[model samples]
Target: MNAPRKLWLWHVPLILLSAIMLLPLWWMVVAAFDPMHALIGGHLTLWPVTWNLKNFVAAWRSQPFGRYYVNSIATTIGIVTLQILTSSLAAYALAFLTFRGKRIIWGMTLLAMMIPVQAIFIPDYLILSQLNWINTYQALILPFAASAFGIFWLHQAFRNVPRALVEAMMMDGASPLTILWQLILPNTRPAVITLAVLNTVFHYGYLFWPLLVTNTAAYRVLPLGLSYFVAQQSGFMQWNLMMAAVLMTVLPMMVLFALAQRYLRAGVMHYGIRG
Candidate 1:
């Protein structure tokens, strides 16, 4: 076959995967509009028999989702900011500095990355409880302040930075911190951006810890509030309202994903260009 035909064939799997990914979102939009009666057949659909805003109204009024939104956004910002700071500093040290126990520290970081998050939940909870941070923003934000994966990812990215450039900066009187902030990070834009995006999505969607700590709506995040919203309906619950709530929580992430994709697409770099 021709080059065009071969390229078209290569696009087939991607198109199929995209559709698979979109199917649930399509169903969600449909369910968010349809009446409760119509959704009881246990069949998934993209077509809405109704288009009333009742579900949205009910979902919003059913809980303090407004507060949940605030909590989610604040905690997400805090976690991402701290992760970037801690991960970058640790990664920078691991990449460039000659410190005592460097190899041991690197080994521990790798081990931390390899450990499952669930395994640490108990100890993490105990630490936060001892500090009396349960149900507070600190409970939500503090545990995720450092990410082993972020450190490892940035360490590898930092390693890929041209050594000659770092040496030149050093010779020109650049301090380690200065070199990290100015030279290292700028050149590794994609890696940093990817880490930020991943952390944002993960922390923003975090539910288990919020559920474990927060008992009141005052400190509730979106996911935890969503669970309460679902539980509010006793028997044959309003899936439409639940779908509405879910989509409401997901809308922020969808917007973020859209924004992030634009930058991701423009992330291609030439050899001499800063990413």
Candidate 2:
């Protein structure tokens, strides 16, 4: 085959796959803006016949979504910030510092990563309950502040740093914290940003933990708010309104990924090269 022809053939499959993945999202956009009468009349189409703002307005007014947005944003930011700090520090220590039982500690972290969150939920819940943290922001943010996966990911990135640079820093009497913030983190900008973006996306969609810890609207996040909205439509499904809410819930992460796509690509490349 000619080179151009081969390249086109290779790209065809990827293009198809991309379209397949985006089909649902495109449908969501269509459904979100389609008029409720059209939707209820079973007049579904790939493109909206009638586009209006009614769905968005109705979805927003149907529930306390404003509060949900605030709670979700706050908790997600808090979790991602704390995860970066704790993970980077733990990773730096594991990768650079020579300490007793370093292997054991690293092994434990790996084990923690392997264990499912469900397996430890009882213990985590009990600890929070004893501390009287239920139905509070602390319960939502504290349990996930440190992530074993984050530690492992940053540890790998940290190991990619030049050993000579670290040794020279140490010789100049640079403290561990200084080395971490000044050298290691700066060098791993792509990885750190990638982790932050991924963590934010994951925690923003997190429903199970928030559901278990919070019972009131004051602490309810977006995912739970969506659930409540769905449940309220017990017999009849408000597909248009529901999809509008889903779109709003996911729009931020979509914008984030679009903006940081380059960094995400670079981070993935670094991981493959380093590993």
Candidate 3:
């Protein structure tokens, strides 16, 4: 077979795998539109028995999903923006600059990465509580202003950049910040996008931190909102409604992933190339 024809043939398995991976999402779509009775019938089926968009409307009206969306979007955006700034600058310093305690600081960062967020939740919560930031956007966004993982990810990408290129820019009178912004960051675009998309998805779906910090609706995020909805429907959840709410909760991340799909693969490949 010719090279192009063979390449086309290779896509068949990938297409099939993609469909397989999408099955649960497809099931959710079918369930979201299925009438409550149809969903509760306990029959195994892949298709919706009937078309009913009311599940979506009912789900929305039953909860303050719009407000939840606003809270989630605002906090997630804040966290991501601050994270990129902190990560890029810290990573640049670690990768290209020399200073006192550099190894010790890098060691600390690596140690921080090994420590899970759950392990630090109590301290984080106490810090927020002490600041009287409970239920505020500050409580939600401040703790994540600097991400250990983000710093590590960008640092790896930065190290892959040739030191000579950075020096050349410096020789021409470029400031470190200028070289970082105008040169290094552009070359590491995939890594940045990959981190942004990942961060968005995580923060958008995060339940535990928001649940711990915020008790009021004003700061409630999507996952916490969904839990409340589930609680409200505990005894007999309308499966269709549940599916609709979940779909709404995850829709943003889905769109984000779809848009950044190419960058994710490229980022992984780029990181793996030299590391």
- On TM-score, who's better, 1 or 3? 3
lDDT ranking from best to worst? 2, 3, 1
Question: What is the C-alpha lDDT profile of model 3 across 72-121, one tens digit per residue?
Answer: 99999999999999999999999999899999989999888889889989
lDDT of 2: 0.91
Per-candidate TM equals 0.87, 0.92, 0.89
Q: Could you give candidate 1's per-residue lDDT for residues 1-275 as a string of tens digits?
A: 54664676877899999999999888888889887534468664568877888888988888888999999999999999999999999999999878899999999998888887678788888888899988898888888898888898888789999999998999999998999989999998877887788778888898888888778889999988888887878887777888899999999999998989755554423211332
Best by lDDT: 2
| Candidate 3 deviant stretches above 4 angstroms | 1-20, 37-40, 272-275
How far residue 20's Cα lies from its native spot in candidate 1, in Å, is 4.2
**Cα TM-score of candidate 2:** 0.92
Clashing pairs in 3: none
Q: In model 3, what lDDT does residue 27 have?
A: 84
Model 1 pairs whose backbones collide:
none
Residue 234, candidate 2: Cα error in Å is 1.7
Q: By descending TM-score, how would the candidates be arranged?
A: 2, 3, 1
